[model samples]
Target: MQIQDLPYPDPGVPDAHSGPRFLWWLGRNQLGGQLKSLAWGLLHFTSVTGLPFCVGFAIQAVVDRSGARLALSGGLLALCGMLIALGDTFLHRAAVTNWITAAARVQQLLARKTAQLGSALTRRVAAGEIVAVSTGDVEKIGWFVEAVSRFTAAALSVVFVCVALVVYQPALGIVVAVGVPILALAVLPLLPRATRRADFQREKAGRATELASDTVAGLRVLRGIGGEELFLDRYRAASQEVRHAAVRSARMWALISGIQVLLPGLLLITVVWYGVGLARDDRITIGELVTVYSAVMLLSYPLRHFEEIAMAYSFSRPSAKRAARVLSLERATDTAGSLDASVPSGDMHDPATGLLVPAGRLTAVVCGDPDAAGRLAERLGGHAAEEASSDTSVRLGGVPLDELPLDSARTAVLVQDKDPVLLSGTLRELLDVPGSGDITPEEALAAAQCGDVLEALIQGSLDAADPMDARITERGRSLSGGQRQRLALARSLITDPEVLVLDEPTSAVDSHTEARIADGIRSLREGRTTVVFTSSPLLLDLADRVVLVHEGEVAAVGAHRELVHGEPRYRAVVTRETDEEAAASLGEVLDGGVVEGGLRDGVRDGGAAKHDPPKKDSHQSHGSKHGKPTLSDVLNELEEIEETA
Candidate 1:
């Protein structure tokens, strides 16, 4: 593939069994580019080596004082200069092309893997590692790939020069050849130490990158909690650690460089000392001495490639391995069985939890454990978590979900995660997701109750009130939490899938706004399969059926109102209360009052309420023996603290 035709039509699956194998795979894929680079490199170095020969011949012509010979030598020198200029220019072009194409191919493979595995990939790999791989690691891999042909050509040129020297002067050539090998191989013994130091530097750098990424992601939260300086100090220490490791690595490399210069200088001195003796004895001409000396100087250039190749391999090997590991990951539900290609219009069932989402109904799942609910939501959409059992499965229309291809499964069932990402783009572009049809941006925005979101977008930009063309910053960071969440919901609703699974879609919104969204979703997806995972009362009340998951099992299935009255487990989980609290709150709940104790006086509907001051005996200590605070318990404590303040 040409460099311009980047992101290959099918970048093809990578051979990720090992780092070396992956490097081999990259070379094989871009053989054409490599060959072009090789040809240019050979031409460039050949011309460079010829320059010393031309100078030697020119000197001979001047000594003879022959006009014809001088003219011939000058012509040859000009030809060599032209070749050198042309070769240098083209060689650089070819080498850079190889670098860009190789990097692009690896990036394409990574992009495909990311899309194939989705959030599952992040669970298996650190986000920082992925970031490092895509940025710095890619360049190192490309550097090695681009260096291969140039190094080969440089070695070949050195060999050619040595052969020419031996043919020109036997005794001088012998001394020079022996010293060149020693100069190149003398540093090999020290490389292992250098590689170890380099590896440590890379590790520390990765840690620093991860720390910086986390700090940036949580900057808003850190500022709120007055912990920005704490994290900044930690990062400063990490940065210092990286610096120290890099300095250690650089010290080893500097030593290697010093040895390289010392050995070559000694070899050059020895060649000149011997050549000068040969000249005095009339065994070699002055022209021959100059040529031998020039050839030795030229050999130093190729010797540097040995060190470069070593350093490149040291850094790139681990990088390729990380990329390979990411590419090798497969979804837990990915199976080799033939896909059930026939699309079906029937109920979706989760055999593990015995929860069924009947066709043409809105279902809500309630669980005390938010983590469990999130896992169930994934399974419901045919995405098996890494930790989930392989034997456990979900089915749609009597066909096993694992039997269906990924694209088909996604088309049939779409899952909207709790923290859905709103990629940077215009509002219209964000809503214009893949496979979205018929539903206009306005329709989705309406269904998601996104009027306030549109207002926010309009106010942030110079665009018209339509807000479709308003730009969203990366991850929609400029928008409030509720605005981002609503925009994500709108994007999901626009897809109009056969089955929609949402996890806590309204968690960030107020109850009044959430009620509107629930109503809008019910109206828009009136006859579709919609499964919402949430414990919010507004959304639960809107579901056609509410399934209560207790202790990782389905404890009850009924209307939200019916379950509250019939099943104490359901009530306790929903209200986040103890069994005793749930029983005692029944009367107040029946009277339409809040589940927690009465609000402070004059607190209106949905208004924040102050908490009562805690008694010394009521204070919950860090070493308290009770279980971790439930959602209800946390909210109550927050209120109590607010009142005390």
Candidate 2:
């Protein structure tokens, strides 16, 4: 595909064994682009090298007083100039295309990997490291990729110039050949130092970026706990460290640049001085001497490419390595499978937990531990199972999920984590996802209770557009927790996967709203198989079967009401605490014997007589049996009596 057709249909599998190998693999994929770039680059540099020869010949023709030869040299010079202009124009186009396409391909690969790994990707790699790789590191890798063609052309042109000079005049040729090699090699020792400094600067910058990311992600939490200043100070220090490292890295590059310039200039001076001596000694003609000097001057131009190529390699090597590292991370469930087989529609069973979710039924999983619940949901979706000690695996339709094609497994079961992120875009764009197309966006939104959310997006929008066209800020920061949850749920519902697993899908919403969302899920997904990992009674009550998972084992499996009554462990996890117990604990915390006379009767008697009998003690209180008076109520009654007196 052409560069314009970017975000390639497939980025192709990457060789992620090492950074250098990854880079080489990328080069091989874009061989055509690289070849075009090299051809244009060669044409450009060759004309530039030939320009000096034409000038020297013109000088000789002028010295001979031959108008014909002078005109010939002048015409040849103009032709070389025209070729240089033509070649340079297309050279940039080809080279930049290579750079952009390479970057786009890598971005696509990273995006695919991220989607494949899901929430587990961040756990394996720092969010900061990923940000660095996708953003800054991608460009660095592309920079090296594009630089290779230009460097190759420049080196070839320099070699051609040195050979022609030696054939024409050996005395000057030998000096130039020796000096050019020295000029290229002069900064080799210093390159290692510059690369180290650059790496340090990149590290500091990544740290600062990560700190800023964490701060922004938890801004609301920081404000709530008044830790904003503490983190702000930490980020400030990180930024300062980055600045210092950048300055040091820049200094090293500057010193290297200076050395490159000094050596080339020294060689030019030596060539000019030596050529003049040859002219005086009558060993070479004045035009030949002029040609030697002009050629040396031209050599300086391509020689600088050496320094540029060095810098590119130093930066790109590290970037490529990081990209490779991320690509190498595979799902624990990753295994071989035949592409020809169709995915089955059988029950999903996790052997580790011995939990079976029958096909075409809504199953509720109640796990006391939130972390364990999340892991279980991911396992059902064929995600991570790294620590499993058994040879058996999670199976769907009687086949191990790991042995199925990745895309097939993903399409069959979609596990929505506890907190799904909402990317910034218009409402329409946010909900536009690849799916079975069985459910419309409007239907999904209604099922997810997102009518209020849609209205709010439209009202808060700065632009005048249709309600669905209203834009959402990054991560839906403009929306409340419940609104974000509803919107994310809507997006997930629309996907219409065969086996949908939801982890606390309505935890952020109120009980009333949660009840509505639970109904919506059950009704909309009536015929589909779904597994919801939650302890909410509102949701569990609707499930066809509820599985009580305690300490990584299925303790009980039955209807919600049956489990709540028969299994004490399930009751404790779902109810948090019984109403009577909670009320007794709260009643005991009251003062002035309210717990003894009023609260105990109110809760235990289940709405007893209005008034409690007056107690004998001076500090004893009397109030409605169902409603105990608080300290503020007593204070207000006393104030009213004093005013009346």
Best by lDDT: 2
Q: Evaluate model 2: give its TM-score.
A: 0.85
lDDT of 1 by residue, 401-438 (tens): 76677777778889999889888989988987865476
Q: Which stretches of candidate 2 lie above 4 Å from their native place? A: 339-341, 388-392, 424-443, 451-474, 566-568, 578-645
- Residue 475 of model 1, lDDT score: 96
- lDDT per residue for candidate 2 within 466-570, as digits (tens), equals 868998999999988779989999999999998999998877765566768899999999989999998766687789999999999999999876765456677
Off by over 4 Å in 1: 223-230, 340-344, 387-390, 436-438, 587-645
Error of 1 at 458 (Å): 3.8
lDDT of each: 0.79, 0.82
Clashing pairs for predicted structure model 2, backbone only = none
TM-score of each: 0.88, 0.85
